[model samples]
Target: MKLPSPLYTTQYGKAYVGDSLELLDCLSDNSVNLVITSPPFALQRQKEYGNKSQEDYVDWLAVFAKKIKRVIKNDGSFVLDLGGAYEKGRPTRSLYNYKILIKFCEDLGFFLAEEFFWFNPSKLPSPIEWVNKRKIRAKDAVNTIWWFSKSEYPKADIKKVLTPYSERMKQLLKNSEKFYTPKKRPSGHDISKEFGNGNGNGGAIPPNLLQISNSESNSKYLRFCKIANIQGHPARFPRQLPEFFIKFLTDPGDVVLDIFAGSNTTGEAAEGHGRKWLAFEKEKDYLAASSFRFLENNKSDSEIQGFYGALLSEKEVEIRSKQSALIFK
Candidate 1:
């Protein structure tokens, strides 16, 4: 499908600047292999990038859910990462995130493929009234990641996202006979002798609890934003988050999308993984700063300024790869 003129282009993707709903409407049905995004949370306090209040968040997000369902492939997946919120002025937690899951599955005809929690080890203590000052609650460090699929069996491969085996598991693999024998436990599941022989699997299957730190203090994107005197997107997810889903859910040539492409991190991940991607963000400054992700690191300060200057001045700037970076026509 022909999309609008992109704010910037990379070898693997294009980043668009506009309302996501309007941009998504331009796509054809079953065109996307995966849609992974982290929308603005329904925070108690409003942020500069903009966010809906808790009461209106579910209905607001449902509108996009319908559009996403129409565009995604039959076996495709929609992965949503939502940060938890507390009730206004109270210490009570809000149920907006869970509500979105139930609404999408029960009302929007999506299946709950699985649920995952992203544990941000570097997350700060939040809602100072309750957590930091009053000391009534623990730090809110985990974001609920809902994996929704149009079909019961979505395209996924656990092997693609396996973690390295622990040291003990390596020892067991090397000396299976010395360690123990396979047997049934109180759990009532029978352990086969095949467990003794190394299955030749590269790593162990990872758990649903994903441990990633949100540390991007000195990335190229941030450096560019600093040079341009632009404020960076505040809630940028680590690139690993998108890389995980892209590997597990889609092949190299499949299309991946991020509806709320703050700083276009998903696009960068998709590019690195050889997937065609589309990023939609409403803020032009954020999209402009994201172009730095695709540029070669050796670019000088003057050259970088010239590139960014064109992005700001021109109606649309085609950001060709370093091999063809100067080709505007």
Candidate 2:
């Protein structure tokens, strides 16, 4: 399959509206530096955007996994963001996410680089029948983010994704405490004297738990969609989710891809970090509206209309040639 013409392009990224499998086949082997995406969950019920039922989810996703393995460099990574789902009419949560992880590692010959937990505090109480009405369970807010690698050592720099120091640690640095007498802790662990001082870096290594809120009401993208009478993507990953991985797993000028870019948030984040990116989306309306995230807030209506027209235009021009009766190309 030939790589289709880009529907739209920014200074740092390209967005294609079509089957990702076709677009991915056009790339050279080991060309992508990182692959990051939050695919649709295999849920009990069918979603409007699209998703297979839980029974077929793992196999459906494995097809893409094999393609990802071929295009990623030996030191590159493939990060997946999958949320837990519930079994139909049952109180138990599904293990479909784990099933996919196993398929990636054991069957596809990939390695488990690390596991991350994304905690969305603003998530509404889910499985309403089991949690709200029955009062038998708590709110489900944590999602499993599995990071897989093609080799033992993937391209990861935790320093890039470090968080700010805690208040206590910041206070210690202000006190000029360079050395603490080494001693055994109450938990029977030895403490180092350098622990009193900072690691000399501005930020500390972040834990595996990522705290992010997905709620957005006043963003420019949403505002444009409301006025244009278009629905924004129902499931949009927080910009910071892909931003963190792109910074940690890749360097400037490296290529990144999002095969299932529902709203092209991954492209926006990659562009922000000086990385070139490619985004593939199947839904045309969502892809057209996703361009809003790339435009300035002061863009006029005509500019917005032109932006949409440029993406939708398939004007045909017929030429008279000796070898052809009629041609539209």
Candidate 3:
């Protein structure tokens, strides 16, 4: 069967170096199975790559959300990873993400499937003014992951993203009689004996707070970047971020798209899970450096070269100068 061509297609994914909005316009309606991205945060101070200011952040993201709603299939999902930011010069936080969420639901006709919080335990303390000096607020470590669907009933299976039962939970299940007794609580909820059934086949449902460690001290990707003398994307998410959503939202061969693919973490996760994926990044250097993430998967030297050539190729790269949108801290 003949497949539609992308800018630079790989064995398991494609890379497009341009504005995500333009790329979205080129894609067919209802073609993508999932849209997962972590756009740069609207922080008080800009980082290495540029980000939208608080004044324009919501409207800018809303524009893409409107287009994404069209490209996603009826049962498709759009997973967004956004870090919390403080208002410019103020100790208070910014509600730009909430503003975008409201716009998505009210204007874009999207449903709020669920809100997931990603807690990075290894994250360092930041915003010295509040956390270290005045001591008014704690160090911010949790990022918001909004799972929006085209329709209210998007394709999802909790079983795909279930975590293994804890050792304590396992002991409790075996000794329910000794540990947990069925009883009505102060909340007037009935405690049933059926709580322990079918747990062997299924692990417990993960909570909204997903505590995935993002501590990668040294890895192949970093090693490759070092040898190649390339500056990697400063704000890269852990692969586990996308892995959870991709597994929960899509199946094998499903198409996933990452509009703001800093370091292409979403594409890497999708490819690892046997999903067809696409990535769009405006920063040429960052997109070129992100190719290092797949070095281990290349069986031969030729294969590695072929993949790198495709990403850095002049003919393959449709370069466009756009303000980079990325922030993970």
All candidates' lDDT scores?
0.89, 0.84, 0.80
> Which candidate, 1 or 3, has the higher lDDT?
1
Q: In candidate 3, what are the lDDT values of residues 26-104, reduced to their tens digit?
A: 8889999999999988876778887888899989899899999998999999999889988766789989889888888
TM, every model: 0.95, 0.90, 0.87
> How much does candidate 2 score in TM-score?
0.90
Q: How close is candidate 1 to the true structure, as a TM-score?
A: 0.95
The regions of model 3 sitting more than 4 angstroms off are: 1-8, 184-192, 195-201, 297-329
Q: Model 2 clash pairs?
A: none
Cα RMSD (Å) per model? Answer: 1.6, 6.6, 6.7
- Steric clash pairs (candidate 1): none
- Which digits, one per residue and each the tens of the lDDT, describe model 1 over residues 133-178? 9999999999999999999999999999999988887877777767
* Clash numbers, per candidate: 0, 0, 3
Residue 275, model 3: lDDT of 98
